[model samples]
Target: MQQTADRFPLSPRLFSFNYGRDSSAQTGCSVLDAAFKRYFSILFPEFTKDEFFDAWSEPKSFVVTVSVKSRGCDGYPDEDSDESYNLGVGDGQAVLRSVSVWGALRGLESLSQLVYQDDYGSYFINKTEIVDFPRFAYRGLLLDSSRHYLPLHAILKTLGAFHPFTHIYTQSDVKRVIEHARMRGIRVVPEFDSPGHTQSWGRGSVPSGTFGPLDPTVDSTYQFMERLLKEVKIVFPDSYLHLGGDEVSFSCWQSNPNVRKFMEKMGFGKDFTKLESFYMESIMNLTAALNRTSIVWQDVFDYHERPRSRYVVEVWKQGCYLCEMRRVTKAGLKVVLAAPFYLDLPIPTHSWARYYNVRPLAFLVLEIWKSEHYQTELSKMTKAGHRVLLSAPWYINHISYGQDWRNSYAVQPQNFSGTEEQKKLVIGGEVAMWGEYVDATNLTPRLWPRACAAAERLWSNEQLTLNADLAFPRLKEFRCELLRRGIQAEPLFVGHCKHEYDGL
Candidate 1:
C-alpha cells in the first residue's frame, strides 16, 4: 500500500458510483446490491436523492468504479473463495477491483475507512493505493450462543462489524442467521458440542430414565447422532462441523448399568477415556459419512489414537497449548488454538496486555509464555507442514478499561521463532466471544473495536499492523466510524467524535 499526503476532497452530494460490466452483474445479486447501498448510505447518511442530484451540477464530483472478475456473486462464502482486492483512490476517481464479490465487499469496507469527515463537516480521503488480501483464509469469530441466547438481529449486527465466519453454538433459528450472514460475506458454522456439553441437549427431550452424554452404549445413540448430524449437514453448507468433544465426565457413563455392562464386555474396564474415544470415533465417522469434515475439541485428539487428518482439533484447555499444537500437527491434522483466548475466564482488570503478548506457538508458564521460553516446542510444529489456526489474544468479551484495543492489536499470529515456510502453517485466527457474560444488549460494544483489532491482524500485512502505537489514531477513527454505522462501539479514550451524536 502507498499513501500520499494529498487529501482528495469528496462532496457527499456529488460523489457517485460506477460498476464495471462484471461487477454490475455480480452486484445484481440482492445481497451484494443491499451491501453496496448500505455502504453508500454509511458513507453519506445525510444525503438525500434530490441533494445528490442537485450537487451533480457542482464542478468536481468523485466517482468510484468497482470491477470484479467473477460474473456473479455466490450465495455464500466458502474456504476457497478469493478475498484479495486492489484499491486505488485518486485522480477524481477510485477504482476497486477483486477476483470475487467477496473481495469487492472487503474493498468497499476499505474504501469506507478511507473517507472521513473534517471539522468543517466536509469529507476527504487521502490519495492512496492498497492491494489488500487476508493473510488467512478462515478468519472467524466463535460466538457461543448456547450459554446465553442471542437474538437474530444481534447476531446480524455482530456480522456487520467484520467479514468473518461466525461459529455459532445456538439452537436459535440457525437458518435465519445463516441467510442474513450470507448477505454480508459471512459463513455460519454451527457447533452441536456433544458428549459433554450435552447437558443442555437432553434437558426434556431425552427418555425419562436415560439422559446425559448421548448414551454411547446404546445403538439408539448412534442412530440419534446420525439423524441429528444429517440435519446439521443439510442446514449448514459450510465444509466443517464442530462436534464439541470437550470436558466429558465419566461418572455419567460409569453410573449407568447398561454402559458398565457394555464397557466390561468390550474389555474397557473403567477407562472412560476409551469410552470418550469410542463416542468421538463413532460421531466423527458419522460426520464423514455425511460428507462433512469434523472439528473436535482437543480432548478427542489427546485421548484417541491419531484421529483422521480430516478432523480439525480445537485446543481450548489451559495447559501446554504448544504441546497440543505440536501433537496435533505431527499427526498430520489441522489445529485451532483456543487455550489462551477463552474470554469467559475471570481475568483481572487491565489484563489485555497479557492477552496481547500471547504467541500461539510459545510455551506457557503459569498460563503466560515467558519471552525466554519461546523457541522449543512451539517452533518445532511450524516445520511440521500442517495448517494451524491461532485463537489467542482476540477474546473480545474480556473487557478492560482504557485503550485495551491496543493490546489486542499488538497480537500477531506468526510472531514466533519460526521460518517463513513454518509460519505459513499459521493459517488464521478467531476472536472468541463466548456467551457466558455477554448478551444482545452489550454484544456490539463489547465485540466491536476490540474485534476490529483482530480483524486487521488477520487481514493486513503482519509488519504493517505490528505497531499498536501507530495503530492508535486509525483505530480511534474506526471506533467513531462504527458508532456512525449505529454499532454502539465503545469509545477509545475520554473524548468525543467530531460528528458523534446521541442515539447513534
Candidate 2:
C-alpha cells in the first residue's frame, strides 16, 4: 500500500508496508475513544451515536496499554516531561504502549491522524512499529493574552489544535485554558509579565500620570504579585512559569519616587537595569519557593549581577540573538530561541522556509568561522550543552483574502548548517501566534495549517525537509486532515482541496 503516514507532522519513527482496513473497534484510550467518535460522527452524522459506538465496540479493536512509571498518570497530563510512545500495527491487531498515559494520549492522536477515508469512504491504517520522542522537551506556541485577551473558548480551541502552547494573562481564562490543555497533554504556562508589559495590569491599580510597569520600590507591588502568583500557582501546575522580564522602560522606574528611594537605599546608583534585575530575582526566588521554575525573557540575564541556571531564559532580542544566546548558555542557563521564531513579523512569501532555515547554534559557529581569534571561546560558549526551542512563521495577524501565500506551508524548522555535534544542540521549535490582533474566533484559522508546518519540522526527519516537492504535497494533505478533524486551519494558497488526499 502507498503510505499515507508520510503526510503527518512527524511521521511515525518507524513503519512497514503492511496495511489493514480501519475498524471502529473501541480505541484503547477512553479519551481518544470519545474523540474518535466525536470526530467521525461529525464527519458522518448520518450514523446515530449508538451506531457509532457499536462500530467502535467491536472485537479486535485498537489496544491502548499504558505502563505508568510514576503516580498521577490519570489526571491532568503534564507537558513539561517526556511524551514518547511505541506503536505497533500489524498481525490483525494494533498496539499502543507508553511509559505514561500521556504518551498513550499522544499515540492516540497520531493514530487518528493516520486514518484516512478512501473515495469509497473506508478508513485504513498502515502497519507500522514506531518509537517516538520530541527532539526538544519544550515544543511550544506562545499566545500573548496580555496583548489581546483570547476568549476562553478560543484559547481551548487553540490548545486542542496546538498541543503545547502558552503565554496567558487573564486569571479566569488561564484557569480554563489550563484545565482544557491538561486534558489534551498540553501544558499552559501562564505568563503574567511582571515589572514590565503591565499596561493592562496597571489600569486600575496605579494612580494617574504614571506608567504601566509594576513599581519594584513599593512593598505593595510585592504584595500584589505575591497574591497574584499564589493564585496562579494553584491554577497552573506546570513546573515552568513565564514571568516576562522584557522591556521595562527605565523612565517609569526613575520617575516613581518610591522606586528611586528604594534604588538609592539599595545603592543601585542611577542604574535602573539593576533595579530590574532585583525585581526579577525576587520573583524568581518566590516562584522557586513555590516549587515552580521561572522562565524569563533574555533581558533579565543581562541586567542581573549573576545569571541563575534555575531559570529558563527565552532569548528574543532583535539583532543580538547570537550575543545573547552565548551569554545565557555560558552562564549555564537553559535557553529557548524566540528571536528567529517570531511569527508576528511579516515576510513576503514562503514564510515557512524562512523559519525552517534558522539554526540556533550556527550563529556563533559562523561568527567563529569569520573571525579566527574567538574560535576557542566561541566554541565553548556556543555549545553550552543546552536544548533550544524555536518559534517561527509567527502569526500574520491578517487573513490572506484571496491568495494562498506561497511558502506558508513550507515550514521546515531544522534548516541550518553546522557540524553534527553543534546541530544536536537543537531540541525543537514552536510556532508563535501572538494575540496582538487575534482572538478566539479568528485565532484558529490564523494558526492552523501554517503552524502545522512548524509542527512537522519539529517532529519529522530533516531529510524530508530537503525535498519541498514531496513536503509541500504532504503538508497540503495534513492541513486538510486537520480541517476534517474540525480544526479551523486555513488553506495554503487560494482555494481549498475538497478531499482528504486532494492535490497529492
Candidate 3:
C-alpha cells in the first residue's frame, strides 16, 4: 500500500509498503539520538522528557536510523552542498543516510511527516523509501524588519517554521539568531536597504532635519553607511546584503538645497535620479570593501549608468517585471523575482488559487516586449544565462475574515509554460513576509503553513503541483504537525490537534 499521507513538495522519488507493525526511532550516535528525543518530546509534550529519551533509545516495531557522513554543525546552510538523503524501511527498521548534516536534517523532517498519530493515539509509519533533494540552491524568505521590528522571541518562532534565510535587523539580535540558526542549519542574511528605505534610519546622524531616503549629496551619508555596514558585517556573515533601492521618491532630494549643491559638486546634473544611481554605485562599492555581495531592488537600473554585474537586483514592480528581467540579464546581472510574489495584498477569498497560478519564468517576450530590441534581450536572458528567486505568497500578515490566505498551501512557484531550460533559470522563490502589518503576536500564524507551501515548492519536485488534491491533505497534516510541535500556526479549515502541544 502507498504511504497514507504523502506530503507536498513530494519527494523526488518515493515508494511505500504495508508494514505489519509500528517501529521506534533508533540512532547509535548519542548526539543524533538526543536530537530525536528532543523532537519527539516536542511532538508528544504530554509525555515526560525521560519517556521520550527512553522511546528514542529503545527499538519498537518501526525503527528509523539516521547516519550522516559528517557530524558537525555547519553554523549556516551550505546552499551548494548536496542536500539529498535516502530513506528505506524494511523488516521493521528504517535507515536515513545523507552525505552532509544539512541533508540529514531535511531527511529527519521528512521522516516526521511519514509518522503520524492514529485514531487510537498510537504513532505509526507505513513502510516507505524516499530519496529527496531540493531543486534550487537558495530557498529563502525575505522578512522586512525595518518596516515593523520583530522581537527576538517572534524571530525565533519564525525561524522554527523552516525559512532557510531571512533579512535580519537589530545588531543585538544577530548573535541570538545566529546561535539558533546554526542548530537548525538555517542561514541569516541581513538587509540594511540603503540610500532608499532609510526613513527608519538616521535618527542621530547629520543632515539633521532630513528624513526618508538618505541624502545622497551628503559626505556624512557615506560615512554613516560605512559605519552601519561595518556593524552589519560583524553581525551577519552571510554572503549577501540587500541595499534597498526601490520606490525611492526623489522629490525629497529635488527639494533639498544642500543635496542639490552636493550633487552638482559630484558632477551630477540637477536630476535627483542620477543621485539615486550614484548612491547605489557607492553603496555597492562599500559592500565590496566589506567583502560581501550586494542585493538591491531593480530601480537602480533607472539611474545607474552601468550597474555592476555582481549585484543581485530584486525585481519587485508588478507592471514591468518582464522588462526589468530583460534589462538585468542583458546587462549580465542576476535578479530575484518579487513582483508576482508580494504576499501583503488582501486576498479575502480563493487566495491559494491566485498564488498557485504564478509562473516565475512564463513571461511572453512578444507580448511584454515593446520593441524587437527588447525581444532580443529577453531571448538573451533565456539562452545566455540568468537566474531568479520567486516570492509568490508575499506579505503574509494581511488577512480577511474566514480562511486566512496566508495559510493557503498553493504557492506553486513553477507554474510556468517555459521550456525546461527556461524553467531552470528559476533559482527558487521566497515567502516575503513584509512587516508593514505584522509583529510579535501575528507574525507566526501569518507565515507558518503558508510559508511552508513556498518551502515545499522550492524543495520538492514540480510534479506535486499538477495535482492539488494530492498536496492539500498533506499540507493540512503538516500544519497540524507544526501545531503538535508548539507552533501556533493558525488552522487552515477548522480543526484542532487531538492532543494540543502548548506554549512555544
Each prediction's RMSD to truth: 4.7, 7.4, 7.0
Lowest summed lDDT across 10 adjacent residues in model 3 is found at 10-19
Q: Runs in model 3 with CA error above 4 Å?
A: 1-34, 49-63, 70-74, 160-172, 204-207, 262-267, 302-305, 319-331, 360-387, 400-425, 494-497, 500-504
By lDDT, the candidates rank as: 1, 3, 2
Off by over 4 Å in 2: 1-46, 49-71, 160-174, 204-209, 319-324, 360-428, 461-469, 499-504
Choose 1 or 3, whichever is better by TM-score.
1
Per-residue CA lDDT of model 2 for 89-201, tens digit only, reads: 65345566555556756766766666654554444466667777665566678876655656556766667222224433445655666666666777777777878778776
> Can you list the residue pairs that collide in candidate 1?
none
Per-residue lDDT, model 2, residue 104, is 59
lDDT of 3 by residue, 189-256 (tens): 77777666676556433457756777776687799889989988887778778777777887778888
TM-score of each: 0.87, 0.77, 0.80
How many residue pairs clash per model? 0, 11, 12
- Which regions of candidate 1 fall more than 4 Å away from where they truly are? 22-27, 50-59, 160-172, 204-211, 319-323, 344-346, 358-387, 415-423
